[model samples]
Target chain A: MATHLILRKILDTGFVSEPPPAADPALRTREQDLQEEILKVFGQALTVRHVDAGSCNGCELEIHALQGAHYNIEGIGVKFAASPRHADVLLVTGPVSRNLEVALKRTYEATPEPKWVVAVGECGCNGGLFGESYASCGRVANVIPVDVEVPGCPPTPVALLQGILAAVSR
Target chain B: MRIGDNEWPLEQRPGCTPVWRGRVPAERLPALAHDVRGCGGQLTALWGSDDRHLGGGFAIHVAFGIPQGTAWVSSDLGAEAPAYPDLSAVFPQADRMQRAAFDLLGIVASGAVDARRWLRHGAWPEDAWPLRRDFDAATRFEPTLDAYPFIQVEGDGVHEIPVGPIHAGTIEPGHFRFSVIGDRILKLEERLGYTHKGIEKRFEGMTAEEGARLAGRVSGDSHVAFAWACCMALESAAGSPPPARAQWLRALFLERERVANHLGDLGYLGNDVAFGIGFMQFWRLKEEWLRLNARLFGHRYLFDRVVPGGVACDLPAGAQAALTDQCDVVAMHVRQLKEIYDEHAGIQDRFVATGIVKPELAARLGLTGLAGRASGQAVDARVDAPCPPYDQVKVAIVTHDHGDVAARAEVRFGEVFESLRLIQELVRRMPAGPLLAELPTAAAGAEGLGRVEGWRGEVLVALRMGADGRLERVHAHDPSWQNWPVMEPGVLGNIVPDFPLINKSFNLSYSGQDL
Candidate 1:
């Protein structure tokens, strides 16, 4: 029964609401309000599309880990979609490359409005070591309007989850 | 250097005396060049560096075609500019490589017309060549990223669809301009070089051992391949051969890397075709495989495990046994998944003829690895150009005439089985020896070429020693450099929706190519 529930949860799309856990009294009011608003709107269900303007795949590994057995993001209602159109939020990683600028723009255009773009990684926020290349186009902000930036060499999976929840609240 | 069956006279290719002290002849140039062209060869890499100890001459390195042995064409570009007759007229794929040779090494190609600067923009001074003998690694240069000339796609019916250097999903960055007519793609232009981390420039002055680690990191996915190739080249230059046991371990790591990636690709391809279940399940499996890598090895991505002289990490006593058990689990699970995939009629329709790459066209563009092998180009660097432990083991090259998404997936399946078999054999006959030997101090002017069959295809690393035995300039070329061009032609008639499927079929590494 647990396995079936886990499988069902893993297979769930961004449609139904999930039961909320008890909130921590230590959390700020705004944080609680944000969580409530996000659960109310997205209902613990979301599909994410990852975009690589240009990345080293370091962050992608962490993202992949979220969907793995240990963290099991599917249990919470987040899924990865192929096309940007089907995605509720765009998970952007890497410093945007010159070659990928136009493709990035078109992808954003194809995605329906009421969509959010979350930059996840130091490179995504600002072009880390790849900053001074002739073919580079700086950070994610240089090319597209980013909603939230989750910074790390690659942000931890929980951080990514937090960022996703934050995006749905807005 | 083809002396007899498989062995060749090393460092005896065209134009001059051998730099190393081994008395290798320099007379075998013309026939070597001819042998490559006869097979409709593609020039994979062109790199050069200066060395002073062996003889103090600038050495140019060139790797020709898919591995069953490509000619290693090298020469000393004396005070005057080094020039080579254009191979682009013979092999159209040589155009970018030749331009890269000129752009990076300052080697002037006599007959080449299109000399656009690739991977070099206003960072280094006009005359300052980064790969040269006199180049300094400590020097910092600020580059201006203004006024790049992106080609315009013009027509009444044509609409431009620009896709990222940055998009959703945590993948490498590259820009693609699709000139589409309605839903059909007319012209697809690619602009790359966003993540130029100065990898090549960073290798300067480092010991060959340290340099191998950097090479592996150049592209995260093919870490083993790149690291192995760098080690092979450096070892060859230093005359340091890894023990028979170490070779087997390297191959084992290399094959696991291959299998892990292929599984991920299969799942992603399914997702592209609207089968989210396959994507989720396969990705789950992929993550498990990565965790296994971390458990057995140190890194989840298997980085830093492969170093010069030999592998950095040795498998624990139970690790090999655990890997065997995991292999069985993977095979059984994959078989069940394959059954579902085969039963699904919709998947067949989507993958069958979507992005068909004709055999003749594949040959024309010099396609290789899985994409080329799928299209009837039976070239496996491991099988054809046997190296170390692979040299002893028999390998059956997998090929398919129908170069579609289905065929590519099938080839991947075949490789997974072969990888399992090889791993079983490696663990069973595991040898006892020091996993690594102390790297020899390379002389001032030694040059060597190392070729390893990386999971993606053939990975080539050419090394040249600088003054005091430090690295001069090392050129590492991934199979993506040859296959990325073919993506344009492969996707020519395919619909826009099928573009991702076709792109996934090739799965070229932008990080590997951009560096």
Candidate 2:
């Protein structure tokens, strides 16, 4: 009965298509050339390592949304790596806290060179609500150099995917 | 009334929770705690305040939850001494609270077993206390980089493993030191405060309305709960309550928050156990739920939805119908997924008997919320101390006696179903009225307390008005403070590999606790 139910459900919800390719008129030619160059240099795949430098976890939730069936980031050439050494880009979230400042710097240094750092969420971009304080050091740029900044309280999955593409293309 | 032969006069405050405020002699503080315990009181929270400007010297406040209401016991330690007898011997949880009090406000809890720094991680000098009036928030100090002395375990084949403050996944920072042998954990110690953002110190100059925004950000996932609690406290202080429609909307948001969190957790739990299909399915469902939230509420996580006097947004026309339809669809899909998850052999093998927290142990640790319910500690604020809309509707408290990973998962499933039902009822019967209420200016020095049962557990906020209607003090207590310590015992006997599964089952908030 269980197997039959699973089979029936799968058949009913058959063939969820992969997300359509990125199409922005402003960056169409540039992105296409960048995608080709990236494929030639690092193959068609890019591995990312995510770090949370004292966020409210809102941004992390949106980051997790990138892996949902609708986004299906894995269907493309992007995958989340378990360590910085294996990563081609680092996705950092939240306003960098004073306590995690050293850790963030160390994680950035540990990632292999020619790496990109994409700061996600408003907190990561400009320290959102929790700006500079005795306990917090401020935005991601305050501690480490960030390549791409995705600004939102918690950016949408589509925004996150675009940010990822922007980081990889860079 | 007399508490253990001590005649301490008490004054009752009318707010969300039944609060009795009284003063006791500094020496009798431990005795008062003991008496309260003997009277079946649980130590809810202990906080310290510097009232030198008010000529009240330093003050320590302890909240105890009894069957009738919450009793707030206060003792003023003169500025000369600034010390009180510790209550850690009576309530083990008070040990950390006392240390934190000392670290921040310089109020010494004399006789505390562990006097080591709790929150003051050498960010400032040894004598500098941030909470004191004289201390400045802009002061910068070079990192001391002093090593924390963790207690060592000495035995054959016993080794220590230190993990994180930085983890492999996109999780918050918190260090865990485990004493283990052959992959079996003998002892586990947690070092948090890595995410402390000076939230309490920053609340000094903000008004109650401004402080609500900070409260909501204390833990992003439980924004509605924290914001509602803050609003309750502020409204009570201002002698203004939101309209009936506003209360119903708050409940709706709270229920939606509950469902969203449970959906994500269920999926994460599946992924932890290597069940990719379950992860994908549950996450897909969660995405749909979030999309519905955005369509209805205009924000995915419902941020800034609940303000001081009422909710920020109202349900648009025909939105209720759309919500009802989505709820029906989610319920059907969730039911099917539950069947598949239950029948799956691998999930059961990983979930069934792992991470057991006995009921007695759970009660002793003062565990509450979803994890507490999983372990048979059925203390739901909606049922025990109902507020507004919850008072009108009946809530079924879900529990399991097994106290394992499977039990926690089942409790989450059951809660999601309940939340869906509550959402339907709340949306269908929402009263039509003004959404916002005009809040009167709070009297200077007026104090209020707010308590809301968030999806995680009870969220308590204590507010005091300063001159010009500014906030004097705002302390937001998350349930994670009580639940984090219990997580150590939950994972003691389990192998190291299963730690992630057990940890996720509890899923305590590091930022909430650190704040």
Q: Using TM-score, give the best candidate's number.
A: 2
What lDDT does model 2 reach?
0.84
**B354-392 in candidate 2: lDDT tens per residue?**
999989888777777899899998788888778888889
The iRMS of the candidates, in order, is: 6.1, 1.4
Supply the global lDDT for candidate 1: 0.70
Chain B TM-score by candidate, in order shown:
0.89, 0.97
Task: Please tell me how candidate 1 rates in CAPRI terms.
Answer: acceptable
Candidates in order, TM-scores: namely 0.80, 0.95
Q: How does model 2 do on interface RMSD, in angstroms?
A: 1.4
lDDT score of residue B424 within candidate 2? 94
Fnat of candidate 2, please?
A: 0.63
After superposition, which runs of candidate 1 have C-alpha atoms over 4 Å from their true positions? A1-54, A65-170, B2-34, B39-41, B48-60, B66-68, B78-82, B121-129, B132-156
lDDT of each: 0.70, 0.84
